[model samples]
Target chain A: MLYLSTISWLQEGPFALYRWNSLKEDLPLFFHAFLYTIGISLGALALAFVLGIFFGILSATKNKGAVFLSRIYVEFFQNTPLLIQIFFIYYGLPLINIVLPVYLIGILCVGIYHGAYIAEVVRSGIGSVPRGQSEAAASQGFSYWETMFYVVLPQAWRMMLPPLTNQLVNLIKNTSTIAIISGADIMFTANSWSSMNLNYVPAFAFAGILYFILCFPLAKWARHMEEKNKKAYSR
Target chain B: MIQMEGVNKYFGDHHVLKNISLTIEEGEKVVIIGPSGSGKSTLIRCINGLETITDGLITIQDIDVTKKEAPIRNIREKVAMVFQNFNLYAHKTILENLTLAPIKVKGIKKAEAEKTGMEYLERVGLADKAAAYPAQLSGGQQQRVAIARALNMHPEVILFDEPTSALDPEMIQEVLDVMIDLSKINITMIVVTHEMGFARTVADKVIFMDDGAIVETGTPEHFFTSTENQRAKDFLSKIIHH
Candidate 1:
């Protein structure tokens, strides 16, 4: 089990410190790799938020074509393995004569690929609103978009924040998939350490802990907000 | 002013409302009572376009509601509806729930809307609970807030759908009291409720519906005691006995 391996790594940590601590070289590489992972993850998330919200709202609207396109978009990304998706963009973009810059492509592909799932999360957030809110606003003589923006969406956004944040944390964790595609993210650095030290246990476990450090606070805060909003908005 | 001429509504030919025709004068108080699934709710909902009529022209304050281009939103803005569930914006404080429509729809200033909101909240005896969320209030109190929400629109007409059906027996009286007071105002109203006592006290015209058809319409005293329609008499007897 992975638990036993982590324990073995814990037993071997002082050995790793004795072996590499004086070199001080692995420390900078670890921090640099962590920054690259966060940077790419955040960049992709920003893009995902925009595209997710844009198509999410569009897909939910009265337009039939928009709904279909957004539906296809959601299913395509969500049903496919994200690792395969990263590989496709990394390897396939070149076939189209689109030489995507290595790091930029990672961010772009991850953002767009995850954006499909994020869109559904966004759509559900919007859908959770009662029909009466829209009807009530409409009855007040506001236009459809106006009603959505001012009344429906305000309430929807409050509800959607938690789920959207969850997507963000997952997106960060998913950045590890980039290692499969030569994206030079934090996981790749850890892999290099594994190869160099012949210590897969310490390397992968440290990688997981590093991701946890980045993701735990965010996930915790999201859950906290969800509970707080539930109380605040309870009928 | 409101008019429904030959209104025909159906849910996949279930015949929910058939050839419903009526006229509501300004400042009139009309109460509709009937057994379940009798279309009383549908009748009132049609007035507000909450339920679409298959065939008919419904005119409210001279606006033809059946016409899509004639501005249903405009009609609705003038005719506020207080639902049986007390659909207060659950996320908002009582004051925010009251003021949102006024500020957004009427382009009223926040201070002006809040002042109006507070006045209605005061009338409903929840002025002190302005900052309180709808969940914090009792069912009767929430319904009262719903009334205040509707009234703040300064509507020409208001619709009530089974206003007291959800309340506890002890809590029903407070909501009914607010409605009784509403009856004294000039706003036209069409209430769909099973509350026979409320009908007896405040309704100028009491309409009885059965199986999607109007069985009888009359003054409360006449309609209650001396109805010729067997269904109406039966209904009165059953409800009174209960």
Candidate 2:
């Protein structure tokens, strides 16, 4: 009971800031962690989105071999748990003497895990483009790639925005899972803060608010873009 | 000119086209008429390489379509198609629809493509709708834009797959007039239409298909007036007398 008040007294976070130097010392580490989390997650999402959209196009094509390979890729990633998949890359990959740095492996693990879901999102978006559009493009003497690039994908892109944004937010949150593998991102920083300060509640609350700051604006931005795109199409 | 020699097409095991053969001369207009699933649309579709043939050679302007490296794109550039449903790219406005092919495929400059688009739009009487979305236009207006789009490509042969088949009765004439105007320019056209009036007015020749084969082919006067092939007579009586 005595220890509780002492703990509370020391960690009344409002007062911790009064000695600006101590708080300032930790701020850079916290900011670094925050930046790393955002960078890694966004990077992973970029990679996933590229590969996802590419494979997604392949999956929807008429070529039997491309479709078969994409199916296998999607299924394999989806069936594996993301954490186990990360572990496999971080630890098990070394057994085969694959010597990628931890950061790239971390980014790739997250990308491959999310990429499967993203590929499906992209495939359905492309599928939602009416076949008549492609036929019309072809009738105009546009090659298949030209038709897809100009006619089909532009139309599909509007529908893709909401799902793709959702996947990206999911990716940012999934960065917390990286802490288990010592990724040195924001969640790991929060863990270290709680351990050092012996005040789990305030440290977690602080980190939670930081994450909210990152993701909430993205959600609002995506919603606005979706509305604008819908209005454009409606017009 | 377009020619199909004993062409057959299969969708799965079902024979969608069977021993179908046709020939269209330069500057000639031919209309194909039949009941639904009579292979009339498929016959015209095969002419433009939209549908592949299972057997026999399809020649458009004397170039064979069956070869793997067939200048299909070059051939298609020479032959344009107008679909009944008027499948416009929903994301682009009317102006972009007309110019996308010419600008992208033919390497025409933006200003040149727009000028060509506006010219065709004027021809189809859609110059005022250059900025309008397809969904904002009426069925007739949409169909006219479709014609203008095909015309902007400046093909030698124009194929219409039931051009008025999807329009309301009042809207049909607007599209048909654009088609009629197209014919007066002496562009070679092979139109698959159920509009017997259109066939009677526009066609130099009429071909009737039933169960995937050309059951009868002749000049409109002979086929529509004097033909006695039982299936042709029956199909015409049902279509005309009805």
Candidate 3:
């Protein structure tokens, strides 16, 4: 049905593929909106990476309390919807006198929400390392933290990159959720164009194409790394 | 010097080491031989506090192993271990593997650590592979590097837990040769191995274990030739003739 809509839409004059000529003028505006989207996503990703690694290592440690606490955080964020999280932080917080800017709210919502997923990535990555690696370090008189930082994490980090990149792609795509709250991201800009031009098909399709342009290289690089790492570790 | 008096270890309901009592003096080379699952590895692992004893007194140079608050790190610094699988850091170069413990644990400066590390690597005849990662080296070379890693710490004693058992048969000789060189240096050592020849050559004492208890302890000649214990005699004949 979606394919039929795509095929039949080309028959209309102004709604046709040739409409790109008229929309070419909006490219500069789209570019700015793209930058805004990237900026929000990058900020969120940076926040997520730091918090994710912190929570990840905490969850991976031997301390039962730390693991339990991190598990609570992960389960809470992951089980809830991203839209509700953004609304809770952006709108719901103001009822109690916490009034953060919309951009900060967007970044924090995406960052922390995705941070939970990244924590799982970190936990599994560290767990994949053989127990012998850390045991060797411990037998060498390295303290627990020293063994983790020097021996286990480096090897785990290599195994983590492909999956972590996957998280990065997901985090970037999730930035579009900000539009639901009326924040000025790429999707919001696309909505404005579709509303003015009444060309929902072409405008949204263009939006998806732009998202592809943004995300394809990262996806491709992740695949390449997975293959390269497989070969490197096979020996 | 090492002492284990009435030592016992259990893994869940399975008793792994039972009523163990032994003393190892400084500079003694003790070789433990047993069939697989006889708890030889678990016995040596207890000395460095790698595996906690369920009940007993294990003191190394007056440091008690059974005490929870006692500085286990200090004991580990004095006692080094070489594993069956080498267990060298796969991400680190050979030199880095050797130097990590000294630098991180002992607070040795980088230049001196590298110098000490290189000296031991050269002693193991792998100075040329200092910059190479562990996975890049042959199994024999990796085991040699593991020995060098243990030796660079200048440990008071070293533990070998089936160190050469994981190597290819031909590769075993290279690691065993490095170990033989190690014995002549007066470092206290405990070795658990299947290679009866290594036991025959360098051990000051040979201990045979069965069912988590020491079956016999003797000098190399007495342990190998004059053993009257049926278990020891049966074990020796099996490995020697095989």
Q: Give Cα distance to truth, residue B81, candidate 2, Å.
A: 0.9
TM per candidate comes to 0.84, 0.94, 0.88
Over B112-137, each residue of candidate 2 has an lDDT whose tens digit, in order, gives 99998999999988899999999999
Order of candidate numbers by DockQ, starting with the best: 2, 3, 1
lDDT of 3 by residue, B117-154 (tens): 99999999999988888888899999999999999888
The best-first sequence of candidates by lDDT reads 3, 2, 1
Better of 1 and 2 by TM-score: 2
Candidate 3 at A102: error in angstroms? 2.0
Q: Report the C-alpha lDDT of model 1 over B70-137, residue by residue, as the tens digit.
A: 77767778889888778777678899988888888778899999999899999988899898888899
Which digits, one per residue and each the tens of the lDDT, describe model 1 over residues A1-235?
7645865655455445444443245677778889999999989988998889887887778799989999988888888888787778778879998887767877887898879978987788779888877776665567777777776777887778887887888899888888876667779988877787775665677788889999999989888887787766554
Q: Which prediction has the highest lDDT against the true structure?
A: 3
Deviation from native of the Cα of residue A214 in model 2, angstroms: 1.6
How would you encode candidate 2's per-residue C-alpha lDDT over A119-170 as one tens digit per residue? 8888899899999999999988888778878999899988999998898888
Per-candidate DockQ versus the true complex?
0.38, 0.75, 0.44
Candidate 2, residue A174: the lDDT equals 86
**Comparison by DockQ, 1 against 3, better one:** 3
| Candidate maximizing DockQ | 2
